[model samples]
Target: MRTALRRRLLPAAAVFLLAALPACSSSSSDSGSGSGSDAAKATESGWSFTDDLGKTVKLDKAPTRIAGVNDQIVPLMNYGLEPVASWGYSSIKDDARFDDLDTSGVKQVGTAYGEIDLEELAAQRPDVIVSEVYPTDEKGTIDESQPDYGFKDLDQQKQIEAIAPVITIKLGGDGADVVERTTEFAEALGADAKTVAEAKERYETASAALTKAAKDNPVTVTSLYADTDGVSVAKAEDDPALNLYAGLGVKFFEPKPKGYYWGNYSWENAGQIGGDMWLLQQAGYDTAQLKKQPTVADDAALAAGQVHPWVSAALDYVSQADYMEQLAGWITDTKPLDD
Candidate 1:
């Protein structure tokens, strides 16, 4: 699963919307008539759409044989694209939201993060592949300091396209906006208008609840990453993380360099990286060891307990809704009141 802040994480400008759309996109199996309005609708008709790479490929004319390579089952499920093949079943295994799936019928490939074995992916021959954006050092930037994982945002996705056209949706933001990304994919796949409308309505409902929750108590945002070396907080200024929070009008402790995941601050620079509320993404280790690290323990937010560990590890794919709910609660639940 990916982690992105709920607010302040969109591209500097609005992303371009796909051009064609049927009026009421719904998720339905094309019946025998195939000649009815279902087939007549121009927008929700095929999977041979342009990918993030801007290449046009036809995988499905309303793909029935779908493979979900990335971690975005909910949207595809909502879009009515059932996975004939998956990286693994772990993501849907635990969540109640995906009770509709039947794992016995689907092929289990592997994990979502690593490079796919082209031979294996080709063998499945899915009509469409949906993927999630890989985590970067920060938006539009790379973490040069960490060389082993250069951490390029779209690197793995570029390779997926060589197999088939793929749509990369950034996680982190008001969950509703993810539908827009879904719509783009649907247009590519010829998704039904009813599906797009339903997804949009779902997003609108979630956004409204978040808006009310913010009015009840504003949220503060933060991002964290932990590996064997230590924990580093993100100071992001764009897509998924910051953008999600911005959508809710929540505030977070701002970091230096203005735009990046929370910066790497040492003991000397710790004072500057503070926030009224803090959310952390802790590595799975003895909590005591994390508390000993100055970066994890000595920080002001950690001291006061205004910090909560945001959970993304349990999920197979992180969607906009997942990020919004996790971070929104992390921020709101930790709100500091005047004592």
Candidate 2:
């Protein structure tokens, strides 16, 4: 972790989205995201999987050309699936989340919210199109399902579904179960078992190291995302990845979230909670501007230079391993608040 917690703007091709740490309002684990039963069942080159929405996609033969939203395409690529096209917050070429994977030949049809080049995606002739959903109500808790979080509306979802059987999965929980379930999906998609196994081992190893660090240097960690809109104090217990960290012995700055995943407040009221460690969003949070707020200006963590840039890890073994190792190192370096 850099002491300054520096993060520069991404390239013009890259775009930002609020979908990061996609929240779940339901207090129960995995409620915000869909159930964990969406596994790929393969039989003699045929494929079938039940999506989070309870929709079942059965293809007579496994689709050779797979397409997914930006968030999921990278993980499948790591699993040895070559995507023909992608649509998401950022193109694969510019998305930092895919920095570890080679996305040289994939086509990007969408780069921002509520926009997708359907014709362009159709040109790819994908066998199956995949997407992740975190359907939530206005209050930000899980509610009636949305067709596709990436598309503009129900019409767009219908158009895409017309082109190929869309396999949608709900993502939530402490992060471990989703990884395991998705591995089953990748395997069904014909992912190389050796590669997947190797990555899983690394993930487990990193998680163990994180658990050790949390026990050695105990500190209550706070997660924050700030911009011109306002400050959001994330309910660590509500966020799947943060909750996973909590289960690993790391104490989070647990506060009652008024909304789904966060408690929104004006900058004036931003410093409502105190913590030994502060993890700010790497991309959007503006700490320099936040100093204008009296409460944030006097925040002990900021004054002590204990702020760290938090990377929103992708939901995969590779991404999780990197994030965990980095976080574990930071936890080891962080001192207790009382110190």
User: What's the C-alpha lDDT at position 292 in model 2?
Assistant: 74
Off by over 4 Å in 1: 1-47, 88-102, 132-179, 187-196, 227-230, 257-259, 267-272, 282-287, 294-300, 311-319, 322-332, 337-339
lDDT by residue (tens digit), candidate 1, 87-120: 6223446544456555555665654334344455
Best candidate, TM-score:
2
Clashes of each: 38, 0
What's the lDDT for residue 136 in model 2?
47
Candidate 2: RMSD to truth? 8.1
Give lDDT tens digits, candidate 2, residues 83-148: 888977555666778786777778888886657887777777777788866524233243444456
* CA lDDT of every candidate: 0.47, 0.69
Model 2 lDDT at residue 108: 88
Using alpha carbons, what is the TM-score of model 1? 0.63
Range of the 10 consecutive residues with the lowest summed lDDT in candidate 1: 6-15
